[model samples]
Every structure is written in structure tokens, then in C-alpha cells.
Target: MVLFVIGIIACEKRLDEEVFSELAPSTLFTSEKGLSSVLNSSYAYAHRPGFQDSWAAYHLASMTTGEIWGQGGSIENLWLSEIDFTWDGNHDHIIAQWTIYFNSIRDANIVLDNLDNEEFSNEYKQLTEAEAHFLRGWDYSELYNLFGPVPLYKTSTDDPLLPRSSESEVQEFIEQELLAAIANLPVQAPAYGRASKGAAMAVLCKYYLNTKQWQNAADVAEDIQDLGVYELLPNYGNVFSIDNEGNNEILWALPKDATSPTASQAIDALVFPPDYPRPNPNNIVFAARTYLYDDFVNSFDENDTRRNYIITEYVSTTTGEIVPGLGDDRSFPYKIEFDPGAVGAAAGNDIPAIRYSDILLSRAEALNEISGPTQTAIDLINDVRTRAGISPLTLAGFTKETFREAILQERGWELFFEGKRREDMIRQDVFISNAVSRGKNAKDYHKLFPIPQVELDANPDLVQNPGY
Candidate 1:
């Protein structure tokens, strides 16, 4: 599973468009208002309902880590491939994520291509281009995490039929693109959900961590801290609450519209069991359900406020009876709390794509990996621990190995259901073993999901991943 990292220190980091489909690129590129709408379209696709609900990170990745299970839906999802590790190219979640990444990239390219339009001022054009890069880089990371080196559609003109890029090319592209984005994005975003320096750098830090570029990862973490705009909010439970969407700790998020929220982003559809008493009587629980694996629920120290999201026992909505979580079966994920103003099941909670706490944890792990455990690493971890209402770990208690394991556990506790656990397990080299230990049929090759069968059929030049 070792990947070759090229001179990434030298190099630098898409989503949907609406009018893009209806109008010619030339026509759409003419006016400032027209161009702006195209850019907004990209955001819509990138931050669409599936982004938060159960696309890639939320289900496909988390399920592989043996942390959660999905059930009760006719619509296909990773739930189809959840427990057995039997998903193939046709897996619904796999195809959905693949489409999201490529389509997102396409839209970003559309925006970039139109940046030269004279209607917008030069400064506005530069900002627009940077925003395009940030989104394109974000989707690229999503694709790389799930599928390794996918076909590198660097821009819209890159042959649609081109085969996969070399791992190094893909890695370098991600780094260089993000570096460009970091250079252009402001320290503070002009508005909510917009990518900022912190968001772009957090992603670069993530790429560095996954590639095992320990020093680069640690360095980016420190750079984010230097921005002086981020900190862990005092309470873990409130971070994801619907009422606290754009709080200080959230570096960047996929925000829901206040007036007309997304229907598919109904995350509570999976979290609340049929009978769990929802604080909002108006919310609709969809057929889909997500239950925490009992072991994951039990792994947390009872004192960790983060554990508050795991609803183990609740008053039943219909029977007015108390229902206990079925061991290893039905503990719920209440991360995106019930949204009373919801369109149906969707919540107003802005799904956090990157957070301040992630920077601290990533830096701690990277430092430990680079030079073994250190006081700086310990303090970074303690920052998260303190916010979670848990006791801090002493430097004396951990060696490199133990610190690595502890940080991995801390990540699970603090960031589970936030779409980061798979990378954590993979970076820690336990992705497959954790599955096997839990009696799953995982293999080394299973670390990367197979390229979708439809993608292979449509683009003859594309090669499928090994063992698919």
C-alpha cells in the first residue's frame, strides 16, 4: 500500500453548474450576473444534499472501517455493501461519489474557462478563479481518497477518455492546485461556506497526512494555526447542532439554504430510529437508517461529551416507550441534530467539511510520525481532549506507537460520522485488519474502491483498479 511521493514540496490543489446545461459556454460567459450564476451552480453541486447525507465519506468510508452500519432503504447505497466488504464497481455509493467528483470538477473547469470574460472586474475574476480551484481541489481529494489515481481531467479540455494519471501526477496536481488556492483565498471568507485559506490548507494537510508526508502535514497544521482565526468551540455537542452552523471552530462548511434547504441532505433520516423521540414533531424520518456498531459506541470514555451524539436509549416516538440500542446493532448517529424547520427530513446544520480540531489532531499525528511523541504533539491532542470533556494524556504515557494509536482513537471519538475515519484507519495501516478482525473479507487491495463499472464501459481508455 506504500505510495510513491514525488517532489510534492515543489508542486501545489470542482462541482455542479445549472445554467451550464441550458446555455452555450460562450453565452454563459458573457455577463457578470450570468458568470456568477455558473459559479454558484458549482457550489450547489459540491455542497448538495448527498455531500452530507451518505455519499462517500459519511457511509462508504466509514462502513469500511467497521464503525457503522446502514439499513432500511430501497434506494441503493453503501448499505448495500456495508458489512460484508462485498461492494464491486456497481456499488451505488461508489457510483454516486464518482459522479459527484467528476461533475464537480467539470463545473469548476467551466468557471475557470470563463474567468477571462470582461464583464467582471480583474480582482473579481481572480477571486472567482481561486474559488474554482478550491472546489476542484476538494473534489479531487475526495476522488483520490476513494479511488487512488483516477483519470486526471486537469481541465475540461483534458480528453474525457484519458486513462488514469500516475500516482505522483495526481498527488502533485492536488498539492499544486491547493497551493495556488491558498495563495489566492483570503484569511477570512467573504461569506459563509466559501473556501478560505484555512479550508484549502486543511485539505493540503489532509493530503500530506494520507501520503505520509509527515513534515509537510505538520507544517501546514502550524500554518493554519498562524492564521489566528480558528479554535475548538468549548462544547463538542454544540459544534454540529443545527442552531450553530457557522461557528468559529468550523473552518469551512457546506451550508444549507435558510429559506429552502436541501431535501436529500436529510441526514436525520438515517440517524433517528422509527421510534426515537425527536425533539421536533414535524420532522420526517425517512426509510433509511444508520446505526453505530456497538463497539464504536462503547469505545468512548463515558465522560467524552462527543459521545452525546450516540443516542443509545431514547423515548419511542409512537409507543411512548423507552427503547435501548440493540448491542452491535442499532445505536444512532445524531450528528446533524433534528431540524424543525426542515423541508422534510433535511437539517439546517451546516455539514463541516473541515474543522479547527482536525488541524490540531492531524498535526499531532504527523509530528509523532516524524519524530516520535513530543510535548507539542501531546498539547495539540490535549486541546481536542479538553474540548471533548476528557482528561489529557501525559507525554510520559506514550511512545511513538502508543501515541499513534491514541491519536487514531481520539480522531475516531472527535470526528466520527464527520467523514474522516476511513483515512484515519488507512493512514494508520489498519483499514483492512480492522475489518478482518471484525470478521469481514477485506484485503490489501480493498483499500481503494474499484473504479465504477459504468465509468469503464463509457471510457474505453480507463483502466479498472486491481482485483475488480
Candidate 2:
């Protein structure tokens, strides 16, 4: 990780003097090489707080979404808050998520604020601006995904008492930032992990979809299709393979190092059973284990290639025999690609931020919302279904409502454990009801997480969500 001290207000509960340190007038900005030295910090900080970590990715994203939960593990107690829909401002993961996104946003702001230095060459300035805008937009979108509209800080701020923006206000901000990114971002990023025009457009689609702007969402998704730069890999498993980290299907992914602990993902520890043996010697098991709800795993069709990734049974390392993992130990979520060799749960699997399949699904749903079930929508859905080795749905299948239901289910199956579930259920208007159906005490206000308690206490100007 780059250790440059750029100007940023670290999004902690408390504001300290060091949080407002400046990046200007530094010798590091005198040359292009020096500017490049500090650029990785933006990507590193953004990627670190999301996909590479389990607290925000699995705990808040998947556990609350009704399909997945933890069983016997050290972190099971922590998982209960989200699993039961009892999370609040005081929840540890909620607080961490709020801090995480803002920290990443601050990183982007630091880079953006310094890009204008005359000492630095203008050759790379435009790319740097696009990258910063993309990261900021991505960070804000994720923040809006969890809490409705958080305290909006477009630039680095010494005053940490900014109030939360309105939902429409935040949405417009994301749209503007993404549009700017799309204008300058290259069709293909210079590097695998950098932001591209496709990434920006997909993110804009997400912003529109989440805001229920169907026309805008569908239009942006169509724009991505026109790019002709992305496609689904023939095999779903290989899409996430360490060997295919930046494959054609992926619009954006958080790059992970195979051997670096801080630079890799911990999915194996959170989802795999401790005693289960892995095929590769490098993929060692960790103690943390999350269970696949029996109902959800059973919901998958037997022919689904996607279901094969969810291990219902596994060979126990200690016993040297196949064990009933489904109702016994725990069915593991093996969706995130595991590295053949790495330390503990930190594997080289680059976490996907968005895939071409997501764009296809988004366009289909948006079209469905705009009109009724159209042939175009069905064809788009089939593209994803064909890759999954499942039977395609014809136009004669059903009415508008049924198609919507099918789209939601397809997304649940295809995007499982990729940090999209929580938002998916909410957008489908089933997040709270789905939990209530499963005996959780979900309330209307539970749709959005509360602002972190520390932030509220620190800034009285910040208003909390409807319910505490």
C-alpha cells in the first residue's frame, strides 16, 4: 500500500488534528513518477474497506438479505444483529461500514484535490480525475445503498460536522460525478483494476435503478451493451477464477494479491467450515463458518451450474470422509473464487464490483418496469440464463408481475454472496417482509440502517434515520 500522507479527513467517529493534514507543497508532486507513487492509495483504500474485508461484504451485505447466515463460529454472535434484522446505529458492522465508505471517499477527494498541482504533468491529469470521480461515485453509491443519504462530503473537509444530504440530492450528485467519469474514462482502463467508461456507465445504471428512474436506468444499461467491451464467460466459475481476474465479464473488480494478507480477500474464513478440506494446498480453512439457510439452498434447481459452487457436502480434513455439510456442519458459500495457494482466508480472488451479467439483468428489469414483459427483456434474461445452464423463459411464461418475480429470483441466484443481496431485496420491496416471513421482527424503518451513533453524537447537525 502507498504510504503517502495526502490531505484527508479520516472518517472516524471522532475528528483529530492529524485527520486534516494537507498534501500540497510536497516534493512528491514535483514529477510524474512522484504523482504515480501516491495514486495507488486511492484504489487501495477503496478496495480495502469493501470486497477484501468480511465485515462490510458478508455481514451487512449477505447476512441481512435472508438467504445466508452464520452458525457455530467466533463471529456468529456478530452476525446475529444483521441475520435477525435487529441492527441499529450501535451495531459494530454498521458503524464500520459508515466509516469505511467515507474513508474511501476521503481518499478519492485527496487525490482529486492534488491533481491540479502545476508541478505534475497534465498528460495523466485527465485519467487521474476520471479515476477519482469514479471511486467517489462508487463510494457514495455504496453508502446510499446502506444508509439512504449520508453526510455528503464531495471534497476533503476539516469541518466534520456536515449534515446528511437529501436522497434526491445525493442521487443527483452521484449521477453528475459518474457522467463526468464516463466522459473522460477510457473504454479500456490502462490497468486491470482501474476504472473504465463501462464501469462508470454501469454504476450510473445502478444509481438510476436504485432511485427507480426506470428510463434512465435502462438507457444507461443499453449504453453499456453498445460498448461491446464486456460479456459473460462461458463458465460461471471461471469468471471469478484467479487466472481470469480481469476477464471480459467483469466491469470492475478489486484486485487482490495471492500472497499478501492485507491485499487479499477473507471469504474462505467467513463462508467455509473449519474442518472441510480444500482441493488446493494453499486454500487453508479458517474457524469462521456461515451457514446457507436450508430453504435458500433448496430453492435452487438441481441442474443449476451456480448451485454447484455452494457446497452442500464436503470432505472433512480431520475425518478423511465425506460429511453431510448441508444440515450438519454447514453448507459453505464457495462463490468467491479461492486461490490455490495463499495464507489462511486471504486468497488471491479479485472481488467483483460489477459484471456484464449485472448490466444485462439491470436492463431487463428496467425495461420490464417501463413497459410490460417485453421480448427484448426476455432475451436479455436468457443471455444470463443460458450462461447458467438453465432453461430459458419464453415470452409466454407470464404477466408483468411474474416476470418481475422471475427477475428478482434470477438475480438472487446469480449474484449470491457478491455483496449485492441486501440492496437487491430492498429494491424488490421485500427486504423487511422477507425477514418477517422467516420469523424475524422486521419493521418498516428497518429498510435503511441507522446513521452510526458516533457520527450522530459528533455532529448534532446530522439527523438520524426515522427509527433508531
Error of 1 at 347 (Å): 2.8
Model 1: lDDT of residue 335 = 81
76-103 in candidate 1: lDDT tens per residue?
A: 3557576678899988778888876677
Clashing pairs in 2: none
lDDT of each model, Cα atoms only?
Answer: 0.77, 0.77
Q: Cα RMSD (Å) per model?
A: 6.4, 5.0
Clashes of 1: 12
For every model shown, the clashing-pair count is: 12, 0
Segments of candidate 1 deviating more than 4 angstroms: 1-27, 50-56, 75-80, 258-264, 326-328
TM-score of each: 0.92, 0.91
Residue 426 shift from truth in candidate 2, angstroms: 0.8
